[model samples]
Target: MTTLTTKLIQQSDARGSALAVISDDLSLTWRELCDFSLRCSTMLRDKGIEKGDRVALLCSNRPAFLVAWFGLANIGAVTVSLNTGLVGEGLRYSVTQCSAKAVMIERAILDAKRADLEPVLEGRTVIVFDGEQDLFAVLSGLAADAPYEGLGSDPLSIIYTSGTTGLPKGVLNCHEAFLASGRWMSRYLKITEADRIMVFLPLFHTNPQMYAVMSALEVGCTLVIRPKFSVSNFFDDARRFDCTMFTYVGTVLSMLTSRIKTPDRNHKLTRCVGGGCPAEVWRAMQERFGIDPHELYGMTEVGGWVTGNSAENYRFGSCGKARPDVDVQVFDPQDNPVPAGTPGEIVVRPKAPFTILLGYWDNPKATWESSRNFWFHTGDAGTLDQDGYLYFLGRLKEIIRRGGENISPFEIETALLDHPDIADAAVVAVPDPIFGEEIKAVVVAKRDFPPQDVRHFLEGRVAQFMLPRYVQFVDEIPRTETQKIQRRQLQENDRGMIDLQGVEEHA
Candidate 1:
């Protein structure tokens, strides 16, 4: 009952009538969830899917997704949660990469990408949910009900995350890790069974899986699931379920603050938890919406969250203080520890068991390299203050070295986002003969915004060295489902740029 493998059954027996999850308008109690999950496990086991089997799950935020996810875990199989936004080679790459024994997809997605998924789906056991099979009845006809053998350290899921370069690597995480993170997060957020947490973020991402899905089970709370993030519906959704807390990435807040005509300052939400929240967005959330944003730093490599910001010990601009369960440090290019407040590569090692991921699936080289010097090198640029608070700069590779100065694209992007007309912004390092790397800012604005005005807006706000030499107006900015700007893609993009130096010289 300690492990997530058996927590479902325990919750069922102890809180059978307690509301477990809500999707759209339908709700399920703990008993119903346990029953449904067991059915999924039975059906899969009946189909020869035993322990260690890999199953690709490409579905949206719904009840069926949860059934398949938990069902896979119940039998000790690994669930490969594929991003629903993937198409063509990206979709095929993840399915084949994991060597998934089966694929549980929504009918809607299967129909749309059948051509791209045909090769991998040809011989695999494909279970399309959302009307394909009556899950409640699938196991009614079966159940040899022998003793279930599962371990907490057994991998519960393999989530695929793309790095700054190369193909995506599969991060193999275990039940103990998920269970531990849930408990840590519950305590970090002060979550209780009475706190109804809203999850509009995709479950494929680690935020929802660890913070929302697993946390709910850890504390026996309610989860209100929405299909996807909606700016217009956010105000009502928060109040609709009377949700006390919600999970967020910075993009969600930016969208709500910008797109919504009037920010929902009167919602019942007290706090939100997640990372990638810039200082501007963090303060804006507090002033405009009355929600205290808890921005933590995390990656799939070292479980869910390494450091957290909370009411007890909090910092406005920093990601937060290191969790009591992990040792967080910053290292220089030579992997040596730097002085406090000195920007360097963020690294971590777990203080508790199973907090770090098992390893990259089938990639020993990556596994060994990531855990170099016996520490999980996060590859992110950040610093630790003397008080032990972590300040997250952008990715190390994305830092623009201009005239011997290292400039953070994240800093420039934050300043750009503050502009009245700019809707979205991403700053990337561009090649230059003189300084080796110049700055380029790709902006998505509300209307026709000139590049000079954009440059003028940043006059005194940022240093002259950090100001972008090239500016481009685009309709939209490329982002992953988790709201991370695809910086590698942006760095590779050199099209339609307006050279500010030439424009200034001509004027």
Candidate 2:
């Protein structure tokens, strides 16, 4: 089996002279990157980490993170990436859940920000990269060319799910599966050495890390890393790096369009790819930015993207066709495949060269539950168009039932996002006296805009009952570390804040 280590070798052979990764002030050729990763791998080994061990990494998006990822994999170690944004019990839960053997974190996060997490690091060895007490000072200088033992089929990385429903579940991605997903992306995305990819999303997420980072490395493409997304300076950074493409989420697209400064699309960037872009947002963004944008549907549990819109056959409001060697079907509650244009649960079956996850780490029941009927059930609702374009509706569990009427939060949230004053919106079901459940919207309005403005805008667009009965304005929508809006968290908050009175009168 060809492992990710082999992929790096292939890229190095194909374009040894080409730049593989770029940061604000650094650039690494394929050979140099391999050398760095090898040295880092040896350093990790000297620290008692070996093949099949779980090493938790908590740091910002930097060259070191990528080095650690592939370096650990080089020696057959499984990397567990924790979201540094997580605080208190939530962060601690992820550390304990993974049963991590060692943790490497940035001291700024441990010492300055959340000192409480230090207790969890009491027994475990802590390596604070680039801190006052630097980890490298204690260790001997390691050689770059460490013997690479091929550990194919062994676990390479364990990504924790965003925990939309509950506690985050660790999804194990083996070396074979990780490479398979990367190859599929490289072939489908048409990545090449000439391409300079911009990655603003966190590497902890599957889409950006796999599609943006791994796909580029697989094809010898240059990766221009952004520590995080910044709407104000995104275009400037893209221009500086001469980036040909970038990965995005729906929130990033919305933030770009909300800005007064429009981006020029004539140079460099051909397209931006990611998932959850609303139809209207796409149109407005294309007009404002002059760049064609594509959407992809993926989950961490599945390694990477299962479907994506590409240049050859682009479709609006669709997450593209099923990937090669992957089967995507919309199944009913009974596991029967529904015809095109009917909404159902999305499920996937892997073919040759596509690595399906072995199981959820330490959760056999969930692993079985997600893989029923020889298919991996992706808990998401989608409908396939006649052209085989998959249109994501919403999460199956997130569906709101009011007075026996089922409502999709995606529909209502999209409607609210269309309002000019509304910066962001999330719809969730709240407990109601008579209806059993009612629609409540949490909104983040643009500066100088009021909640009444949003309510008035939605008055004519949707049915009276479909309107949000209660609207709470927040400074920002709470997002997972991946920038995915946590609608479930909003629902929990609405339980305490929503007002029961004042239903919209029928027009």
Residue-pair clashes per candidate, as listed?
Answer: 0, 0
Model 1 scores a C-alpha lDDT of 0.85
Query: Considering every candidate listed, which one attains the maximal lDDT?
Result: 1
Residue 93 local lDDT, model 2 = 79
For model 1, the stretches where C-alpha displacement exceeds 4 angstroms are 131-133, 139-147, 261-263
**Across residues 295-388, which tens digit of lDDT does each residue of candidate 2 receive?**
8888877767788887676788889988777888999999999998998999998875437677899999999999999999999998998888
**Best model per TM-score:** 1
TM-score for each of the candidates: 0.96, 0.92
- What does candidate 1's lDDT look like per residue over 375-430, in tens digits? 89988999899999999898887888998999999888888988989999999988
